[model samples]
Target: MSDPWLPSLITETPQAGFELAIKLSRMGVKMTQPSDEIRKKLRVIYEDDADSLIAASQVIAINYQTVAAANNCWR
Candidate 1:
């Protein structure tokens, strides 16, 4: 079976990765990877420039909302 986190990590755009790491951090989800270097990078991206990260999240939310509305799934 494929590792579930691999898709999210590999497919994420830079903005998406920043937003996702922030969300995961807020949810108290700790990193499980063995590589401390990768974890440190993720932490830096999520903690640094947090406002920009949040803005990216807002953009993603808006895009999803638009798509759902277009599909009549908003109701």
Candidate 2:
């Protein structure tokens, strides 16, 4: 965990920024869980759950907001 995946939040475009946000969200989950087997088991439970899906989307949206702000809204 010493290496850094987020050296900077800057992106060339909004699409890339959004992708980064998704990556950040995913990384957050991995950091929290840190177990591929358990994550897979949990994914089976949450995959078809609409509420869980929406919650995941919300986390991505929040991460996007942070990234967008860091990029100055790409303005």
Candidate 3:
């Protein structure tokens, strides 16, 4: 099955992408939202120059500070 969280980042605007990133980060997933310049770089690396291709963030799995908390402070 596809990842449910994928839609939260890609199917919406930049602000929503930011929120999703934070939410995932709180869950210990380190993610980075690609800026315009970074998008250009990714296009180069992936060699996908499609105009409709949206840049996806790089998510690294690891234990982070936010996830170490006993409670969800983001709420």
Candidate 4:
């Protein structure tokens, strides 16, 4: 089945991504560096506006959920 959480991150905010990453890390999820282009996109989204932080947080939460679900599914 397709993961529902992955798309949520794409739609969420950067701060959300950070928060989600933290939560996932606590749950033993590993993180890898995003590509330069991806990083550039993230920077553009976050650096340009303060209100976008909420979206960032949502992205993170979705990412965390995706990771957790994937791990569980594999196990």
Candidate 5:
């Protein structure tokens, strides 16, 4: 199979940048775990856990901050 292609993190707007941050967060989880079955099993537990969800949002926000800085806040 061909290698996966990762698009540039650079975005044209803050909204888009935030979306990219979310993608980055998800990709990190996938790469770290690399097991769909395990992730699915854990999803059921985290789906309803407020603290877990909040922690996830925090990670995404951090990623957004990094992306924004890299993009110079879209100038």
Candidate 6:
């Protein structure tokens, strides 16, 4: 149910859309995926950026992995 006191336009706005991903108020705001053209453009723009970020972060991931000796309790 919508609030009767609210402006009518606010309630009607969402129906005009292309598509939405999610709408839960708690998890986060909704997002729409980029269209094919935009997705290609974004991939071109960020591919190098992603490679650099991965290279920058790889050492931390390597450092953070556990060096656990096998726990033989179950055997």
Off by over 4 Å in 3: 1-8, 29-75
Local distance difference test scores for all models = 0.52, 0.97, 0.40, 0.53, 0.91, 0.32
Residue 71, candidate 5: Cα error in Å is 0.9
lDDT of 5: 0.91
lDDT of 3 by residue, 1-75 (tens): 334644323423444445555567534412343366765665476556443232233331221222322123323
Cα RMSD (angstroms) for every candidate in the order listed: 9.8, 0.7, 13.0, 11.3, 1.9, 17.6
**TM per candidate:** 0.35, 0.97, 0.27, 0.34, 0.90, 0.25
- Best candidate, lDDT-wise? 2
Lowest lDDT 10-residue stretch of candidate 5: 1-10
lDDT of 6 by residue, 1-75 (tens): 333431221221232111111122111211243366765666576568977557535533332221111112112
Task: Pull out the clashing pairs in model 4.
Answer: 12-55, 13-55, 13-56, 14-56, 16-56, 16-57, 16-60, 17-56, 17-60
* Poorest lDDT segment (10 consecutive residues) of candidate 3: 60-69
lDDT of 2: 0.97
Alpha-carbon runs more than 4 Å astray in model 5: 1-4
| Each model's total of backbone clashes | 0, 0, 0, 9, 0, 0
CA shift of 35, model 5, Å: 0.8
Q: Model 6 Cα displacement at 1 (Å)?
A: 20
**By lDDT, is 1 or 3 better?**
1
